[model samples]
Target: MTENIAESIVEAINLTKTFHPKKMPAVVALNNISLSVRAGELTALVGPDGAGKTTFLRLICGLMDADEGSLRVGGMDVTADEQAVQDILSYMPQKFGLYEDLTIAENMTLYAELHGVPQNVRQERFARLLDMTGLAAFTGRLAGKLSGGMKQKLGLACTLVRSPKLLILDEPTVGVDPLSRRELWEILQTLTKQEHLSVLVSTAYMDEAALCQTVHVLNHGRILASGTPEELRHIADGRCCDIAPTSTMPTRMLQSHLLDDPGITDAVPVCGKVHFITRKAGGGVAFLSKYPELPKATPSEERLEDAFMILLKEDEEKRSSNIQPPSQREGDREAVVGVSKVGREGSIDCNVEGNASADTDEAIVDITVRDLVKNFGDFTAVSHTSFDVHRGEVFGLLGPNGAGKTTTFRMLCGLLPLTSGKLSVAGVDLRTARTEARRNIGYVAQKFSLYSQLTVYENLRFYGGTYGIPARELQQRIREVMEEFDLTDRADHVAGELPGGYKQRLSMAAALIHRPKILFLDEPTSGIDPLARRSFWQQIAHLSAKGTTIIITTHFMDEAEYCDRMMIQDHGEMLVLGSPSEIRERMHMPDADMNAIFIAIVEQARAELAKEGRKPA
Candidate 1:
């Protein structure tokens, strides 16, 4: 009931968790962490994997007991009054626990009954949840048939069926498409404001973190830092710069070259540029001057990630510098590494095909498909498709779920046999030179395919060996990647244990182990947080600069901006292709950004089909 409002809904005191591994003696998941979450506020639990974020969520939800200390949800002790807390709170785990066999409506109804919601409220809440989640039109649709984003919405709707006072969401947006993620967030914002709900959401996305009223950064079961995004960024001391490169390869090389140099605190690849944080102003310029090969350097301010990186680095240095405590060096590292910085934020569903007629001569045609057609029994997955991915360019292939993008991607990777037409990669016909084509292309599939049980190093080694990487070269490459990607510390961490961001980085490393001439990424940044996605794109930009052709297919339109060129496929047909500007222009929108253009174009297409009395497929 909205009548009763408590100040502190969730509170924890000196929470601790420990477990022993098979060979290892012990591992502490949470180490003496204490926190308080207030009512009618959205709090973000931000962290990488093994940070005990999930464990903390579970403890507050009464799913488990902490080895030390206590937790209470809505003023009820979670451990002492587990059932009471469960009734008052709703916990949506990272997985969301959707029943695939059930239809959307059935799933909601089932959860409603479980929560003992009154029959009268059940129908009303069900309708509201569906509308909020944009699932009203497809309540009859099987839950298994929904897309990643849609399924997440359905899960959220089910969790909200009973209108619990406290809501705990664990990585709810993982693997969801950009449009779906935005939609979900919109619903969350509305629910929190309208219902005055107290929400504790854990996420990997920094952009989402920025949306919260408060944030707590968890690392190795401890709060590394806690505050609002601005508060945390203030600790950076003004020392980060977004370095837009005139050339991608040189920029990436410059970033890697500076990794061991103490002057550069953190360097990550971003949308077509390398972003770096330094210990002091002009450090980037100074570093670039040392490498005459690099273009004239630019100085900028540190971002949230920059601050996070600086903090992580400070933590590392403190551990290594026996005489120095982390706090002691805080002032020395106090510069907020930035020429001037702020997180780039906006809508996400901005994408479409390009229409730029400008100089096509520079485009290196890596993959050429003409009149491509693929069909399964009684169904055509792809039909009359054509597109070209230029050399050293990030290309995006976008469409809704079941829109044939995956099928097309599979055929391009030579994982599936093409029904007809020509498909060539790196100037070689895939049909005739499958081995050579495969050799020249690196691919990270939608479903993670790495050895989950193995350590990061072991998995990389395994992939490198499989790809025929020379032992010495492989070792060197592995070491370079580990250090450059800041994954050296996680080299021994179990692959499955690595956070979503690290897992993506590891997968990319394995895919590129052989240094393929062309890279194919299928929804590479799907499940991770915005910060991780940005970092991952930085790596991609690095590769693209090296003349490595990149063909990426993603549902995140905002990501399309990083692409030199992109193509949109809908219902097994090529709808558009060109750069972001060109695609926006094609929609006849003046100065509208990608998201607006995308919505306009899709809606226009749908309306046109309706007007023509042609049923849209």
Candidate 2:
């Protein structure tokens, strides 16, 4: 290591890790990677799933020993002095364990005692942590009842009961909402600034990576690039453009079309426009002119994501002679004709001249909820919520964790009963004919719900059989869907053994086997990579254009931009409802990014509730 051992907080020299299964091929979790982290700095390790980020963090924290090479944490040899290294460092894995049955105060006290914190100062430290994490008010509440975001915060607090010299977090905000993510980042920033803490965090979000003082991009167990956000953005400089679609075309449609061009490195729908990067530097203009229907493109500032995608694409191209990049897959281009046909059959008419709730003409409504309410004993999960979703529209439901988004979605999909009010799907009242209504809809749950022990093909076949498709037709449909999802090659692979992207693709494939009119996706892109997300959204765009109604719940705020309309919910109540642009205009923050807008809306809602002499749940 070139860096002084006394000055660097963490250092790794030619480190490698390999995992050997009993009968399977050896998996290289980390290659010969070298890096150094200076004291009192926030260093980020960013990559897609299966990129060895977790392994690196584990090695550094002495949770796992490296197979070869040297590693040091807090100026101690991690492999030789594992306990000593661990004593000075705190590691929070992706799934942090907390005593759910205990109250927040009890959990914090337990962790503090375990860390050997002095009783004299423990009370003061606990008070500060709870206040800083915004959980002081909920100190007496059971940890199990806390929201996902709250649980994450509590986990952080427990880890920090007695501050270690180094803190390592693995995907700390994986499924956290935009507002909660902002809060968590604020806490981390304050610790780094005021306490002079050293943090090594692994994350998949580019936005989070941009916040770090230094970032290392890892892929397939190798360190591909390392630099500051500004330094990395230069890699894609002059190749990025913001494309405004013509009035006749949707932003997603234009984005899908742009990705079809081989020269276009990457394309994503963002803020009512398509942000894309080209393969050649300064070739953005030339790439735009290829499609006359596209509006005049403007040069946009390059982002860290643009550079990250460029680097991944370049690396893929260099490795394979016949690179079947995810962006250029033929399966992604398949037209989803089922969406349009379903939309026409289920379109709803609203009186635009007067009240938005009044129907002016006879039309189909894919999903209808009126005065919907769900209660668990005395606690209300959903409170008199009402909404109408037309066919072929992409409707987004966003909220912080434990905001009842899932409850509403379950009721709409006929998985749960409403406490009161009417619910309908595809013109069939779910309250009256839930079984029949379910036939017209497909649902992909937040977690992987497929049989993990079964192979991909077996799982698809089983789901198809349950839907009552004939044997011959089921086989044919399974083959076609697998081919469309680019999973034909992995047909025999165990579902549980697949990577994050493949697992997601298999989940969607299984859901669409019956070709339902409406599709419900819950955090579909939660843990996947940027490339996989692009491909998944491309398929979504195709379905939407073909007239399929999509209802989704997501934590990624940027994804709200793709929806025709979205609703923000908190504390079992709707806060805002409109298109992304309309929401921005309503909040008087037209130029603000989605994260800022989300935080502002939620905070504003909480303030309004306070003024009304009511707490937000």
Candidate 3:
């Protein structure tokens, strides 16, 4: 191996971390892991929860000390020169240390002064960050009042105030909107090129993985694999394929069935499809022939997640092959149904030419604005905005923080009162039939909404009971949900104790308990691992198969493709609503991801609005 320390900005050698537990022996957080990060490069630290991603970031930032290992930043030892490391590094923790009550400008100024950034430099940097993050007009707005995505951007700006050599971001986009995420990524790209900054960002988003020059896959407190996206993809060994099934069951069934077959290795859900990894050659074709109803086989490119799954499976297989204890020699169990499905709908509303379900040949919607209007203290948050939802959508609602996606959703769920215009669910008006209208709804909030103190089972029970489900009926429903979400073991765990994915799963199950006619999901998949997100969508697909309509709003554009339709709302105005493909077509841009399209749409809309002498948000 080449040891070019002169060019390397971050170097780690045999790094190990351990935590002492009250009742048990010391637990190793990182074990003999070695890696290097270079200047002008973005590195992604990826893995499931409890995978030591946070620990790794902490060690690099000198937030904590390693038990046995060495880490160097800018040729300075992290353990030996703690203050020196802290001085040159910008570490944005997963929970941004922002005072919510502070104004955006105040927050930036606070951090800048602490870092002793020159007044002139601070003003220049603040202006650039505010404009780039689209918070130029909202500098006086309270940080707490900002949307999740905006808050993330402000936190990033605060971190950048000092202009550190190395930037460490931990799950920075966990709960932001897609447009904001795209902007943040663009800013990072600019910083890397202009400042030659080294960025090490930890994320659960696979799409973000593509932006990184190097991706380090960590699991169970150890580095599993590391490489560029292209190099990592080869680990799949040509077994991955985009297998379109006749329906969703085959996807899950195939995932389970493949585990039982010796030739197959692993299967992960992605973009309304299943990515299967199996041994190369004759076995895949022969096994696939067993499911003739599905579309004919076609070799698909391997994604980063696919490679991660393949490596994880191979790791397991290697462990199994070793002479170890029986506890470790495990066989494949029945694939549980609790994981979410892909190609799930984005909103419950779909516009049909004549019939209610006629245009739904595609799943997911682009947008659905139903005379959505809201008011507070005689102030109108939204006016009578009427729009339709198209299929395969990644719609966005843009505004300062309160321009009304939440308000619209609240009314749709009968949580808020609407002043005017018709609000329909699928085809039924909520005013006339709220119960019937909400049968298909799912909703997730920016904050944790489920019972934090209650166990997972108790929370689900509460939801089922509130829906007036009979005990006998509810029990079966609970079992099915638990199985589908892989929450069976977590059934007894406290809701607060569960990881982000499990909490999200419980919240979803609660929303879905009624088996509603349509689903209303608000930011449902934020703040979870890439694998967890894929698994969550798997359940969404399963629900869609039962003909349940889904409506969700999110800030992640990678997720936009899963929707059947989408719409973009800015300053309470419906800017655009169409299929993901149509949205791209409207922008006349190909190969532009959903986030990029959203940016273009908002920028173009703002430009037109400005030319008309109208204030744009």
TM-score of each: 0.78, 0.93, 0.78
* Each model's total of backbone clashes: 36, 6, 54
Order the numbered candidates by TM-score, best leading.
Answer: 2, 3, 1
Give stretches of model 1 more than 4 Å off. 1-6, 233-284, 287-310, 320-364, 374-383, 399-403, 426-441, 453-516, 529-547, 555-562, 570-576, 579-615
Tens-place lDDT digits, model 3, residues 268-334: 5344455566676334555666767767656777778778766665665675776431110122122
lDDT of 3: 0.70
Best by TM-score: 2
For 290-319, candidate 1 gives per-residue lDDT tens digits of 657655546555456666666666765766
Worst 10 residues of 1 by lDDT: 338-347
- Over 4 Å off in model 3, which ranges? 1-3, 18-28, 118-121, 124-138, 145-147, 236-283, 286-305, 316-370, 376-381, 387-403, 424-443, 462-480, 513-518, 575-604
TM-score of decoy 1? 0.78
lDDT of 2 by residue, 422-485 (tens): 8889999988899999988889988989999999999999999989999999999999989889
